[model samples]
Target: MNLDELDAALRREFTGAEAERRVVVRQAGDLADTEKAETDRGVPLTVDEIVDNLSDAPDEGVASRWNWWMGALEAAYGGYEPFQVRRIPKE
Candidate 1:
């Protein structure tokens, strides 16, 4: 999904400052890139897939949900740890 779609999907699940939401979208784009490279099946993770993955996340915030998703990816595939959203700047 494009940034706009990603942003909208994120909006449905997460409530946060606009600034924070922007950062999450940017980071999600980076994760998309990483998924493109990591996947051997040639199908990158779609926006729907991402939202579904985050749906079961144990945390409430956007950043936490993102980190949780990336954490799962990291466990299944090494090298995804770097893509985890470590810090979301305060708005």
Candidate 2:
């Protein structure tokens, strides 16, 4: 999905924090761009896949869930650390 669609999807799943939501969407876009550049190396990222991956995370917030997933990817792939949601804007 495009960035707009990804933003809406994130809003649906993670409500209340606008800044954090935007951060997640931005990070997702970055991931998509990175994946697109290396299409042959990894699975293409989609809104559904992102949501599904974070759905079972042990965290309660969107940023937390996203970070959890990013951490997993970093542990397995080694480059996803930069995409991790480092700070959540106070809301």
Candidate 3:
């Protein structure tokens, strides 16, 4: 599905508090990598990697649960094509 539709689904499935928490978890992971790269500068993590990390974050609400559900839907409808809800680059 399109980004707007995915966003709407997230909102409909998640409570406001849960959404905020998810954002915090994702941002924290991204920021951690940025901090690490400041010193090493060897391999800056890609946006896709950061988003993939977030997908593994502990489920906090229906929004997170729906993420898995959407994956299943996409797999069935899109012929097993990967569906990433977060706006991250694809390799």
Candidate 4:
């Protein structure tokens, strides 16, 4: 799914597996090359540092948004632009 779709799912879906995995933003290029540095201060967006951090824990009114990145044994981010994602067996 596209990042936007993943984002919507992250916000609305509850798989009851918060402890399994988490997600972080990743650069398809060097982190220093983009404006994503701003998310370091805690914001959320894509391709721009202005809003690049994951959403702060989703509140009770926001569904599972917070659970998307709060607890996990592992976290992953896209390694390419228009960041496409598919799941495959982990080696």
Top candidate, metric TM-score: 2
Give candidate 2's total backbone clashes.
0
What lDDT score belongs to each candidate, Candidate 1 first?
0.74, 0.79, 0.42, 0.31
Clash tally for model 4: 5
Model 4 alpha-carbon drift over 4 Å, by segment: 14-91
The numbered model that scores best in lDDT is: 2
By TM-score, how accurate is candidate 3? Answer: 0.26
Q: Kindly provide the TM-score of model 1 when superposed on the true structure, using C-alpha atoms.
A: 0.81
TM-score of 2: 0.84
For model 4 the TM-score comes to: 0.19
Task: Estimate, for each residue in 1-91, the C-alpha lDDT of model 3 and write its tens digit.
Answer: 1334334444554444545434433533443444543243354444433344435646655335435544553555542122233542322
- Per-model TM-score versus the true fold: 0.81, 0.84, 0.26, 0.19
1-91, model 4: which lDDT tens digit per residue? 1444443444344332322212322222233344243244343333232122234444432223322332220243332222211222243
lDDT of 1 by residue, 1-91 (tens): 5989888888887766667678778877786776643473365677777788788898687777878877776776666777676676776
Q: Where does the lowest 10-residue lDDT sum fall in candidate 2?
A: 35-44
Question: lDDT for model 2, on a 0 to 1 scale?
Answer: 0.79
